[model samples]
Target: MRRVYSIVVSAGLAPALILGACLVLAVSPTLVPAELAGLVRYGPFLLALLGGVIGWWFNRGRAVFVMALLLICYWLLVGNGAGISAEGLAFLQIATLYLVPLNLLFLGFTAERGVLNPRGIARMLILGLQIFVMLMLAGQPDVGSALYRVLETRFFASTGVLGTMPHPAMIISAIAVVLLLIRHKPLETSFAAAIIAIDAATVMGAGVIQYGYLAATGVVLAGLAQEAWRMAFVDDLTGLPGRRALGHAMAELGNQYAIAMLDVDHFKKFNDTYGHDVGDIVLKKVARELARVGGGGKAYRYGGEEFAVLFAGRTAERAQEPLDALRQRIADNKITPPEKSKPVSVTISVGVCERDEDTTDPWAVLKSADQKLYRAKQSGRNRVVI
Candidate 1:
């Protein structure tokens, strides 16, 4: 049953079906005037449809399923109803009744899953479409009346990206904010930055004060959210992967790669000799070196006096050169320990293992790596063993 439902949700038919129904109602020309009220009346259904789709996409069962059902109810409530017009409500129904909810739910779901990287660039792309639609609406011949119609009735108000794109120039600013937030990384490339700037200008030209404020606030909020997420998944002390981050990464990567457990040799002894503060400094220095050496692979602080490195698409034996160089780098570099009043050096031991395809599990692979690490320590103070 669960599998069947998920399949249904993932289908493109979900949104397209809703849109088709609206299109049918639109072409038939009902006596009921399709006004903003009628459009707003069905907003919940739109939201539900979106939520369900997103839920299905991200495997979020309950929220998505519930939203889909609620949306169906909305369709029933507004069907062939009096006071709904066929013409005026055409775009309203399609956008508010369908697109808004679908996009909102999808966006929220993707964000919640921590998969908002470039892989999900489609989310950002849809947002761009919404912005275009809003701009078109704002430029309508009777801009004032259209604005009043969309805003006053709260048509598609439930939609998260601040109603349809067509607000005053100021509203463009708000859209800019939404765009920035939805982006995984801050815009740095020249073309990207220029596009963003142009989008902002369009919003300002629309003359929507609230839009400007919302855009600014949304950008800041998105940045904050991104930072908060990073902190949640990052190690503060060593700048290595924190335990929580490691878990999240494992959940994401599953059994697709190799695991290497690396530990600083005699870490506790160093702390005892140099004090915990200096110990912390040494750990950070080591983490930096590890991150630098690992390249492309992730480095994590597994726990006290221990670090973990994950190498993608490689076997344990393949890590020999990199691990050897890492150990050598640490031994050769002169690290100025914090409050140590002098420079010092440190060494690290590494245990690496490729994922056993027959028994593909991170924990098991990690255990194997740990065992190898133990062997390295037993063999000598500083070395890499598989």
Candidate 2:
């Protein structure tokens, strides 16, 4: 409940600040015509007080700070020319409300550093506007007019889901992004396509061009493209580089690098006893340990139960010391699997090879490493041999 309250408070700060300013300035008998003062002052004061409490309670200090500034600016500089009539006052109130919710929506969905979520947050917002249009369709004479009516409609409608808040459309887009990240079905195909179509339809049907929504679409598409690249070159289970990625790393390393091929010993037996799920956990643990062990070097999941590590700008002799230390650390570390009594104690067999400008290509170096790995496995499953 406290956390929920905090979220609400954080969410409400901006509007509260804006409304509070309008109320204090407009209601002052000295600041405006007396006939226009009552509603202008009272209505916003109530809202501002409500929003301020929520903002303060929620720890939205940044918002509060900004809101205070906006309030002060408007009151001192813009108040007289800003108008004090009922219609004018209402417009101010509604516009503030509209801006607040939109700001919150952006804050909630954006990444910490301002990278937009690449899954159509914009399209969903437009779809929401379309829904709002449909809801008020009967009351309005034309679609364009209904779409254009946001400034007029915002005050009352902003309280509803389709207004300032992220509507179902936004949520759907977010879900699609998550799906793409996790490789869940429908996200890559039908759902994504449908979202695009709906947004286009809404834009055309309502006769409104939403640039924000288009921008969001672009972001989500970029994210989807990034996801695709990861899928092509990253191991899904451990989120490490894959064989293709290893090749890329080797190319970058050129001739001045050593490669170590790592294979877990008795992995098949371990999987049979622990079941594939626990086996997966063990593999992930091993991968993490290898990553930690490799430090600045690159590690790859070279297909099932086998791994590769590439050390750039290092000779075989230079790589040997850390590689040996890594072997010992793997032997020493306690790795546990899910629902297991003791960690599925494991060690790796590694084969090392270096790329030389005179002789070895990436493939040859890899082949040599594979041969060495075979020798290590053949001799003993728990040792590293070069």
lDDT of 1 by residue, 1-386 (tens): 42343333332322233333433433343533667534434444444455445545554332333343334323422455234344333333333333333343343334333224444344445455664564355345365245445543442344433443443322433453355345523211111222232233232332322222222222222223333444565676776658887876776664457788988888888878878887887788788888887635778889988888887777767777788888999989867765556777788888988887564888788889899999999998788898
In candidate 2 the C-alpha lDDT for residue 213 amounts to 24
Candidate 1 regions off by >4 Å?
A: 1-206, 252-256, 338-342, 357-359
Superposed by TM-score, candidate 1 places the C-alpha of residue 123 at a distance from the truth, in angstroms, of 36
TM values, all candidates: 0.48, 0.51
- Model 2 lDDT per residue over 303-348, tens place: 8999998988887777777777777877787677667677657788
Number of clashing pairs per prediction, in order: 23, 4
Alpha carbon lDDT at 70, candidate 2: 27
Model 1's alpha-carbon lDDT is 0.54
Residue 165's lDDT within candidate 2 is 27
Which candidate number has the best TM-score? 2
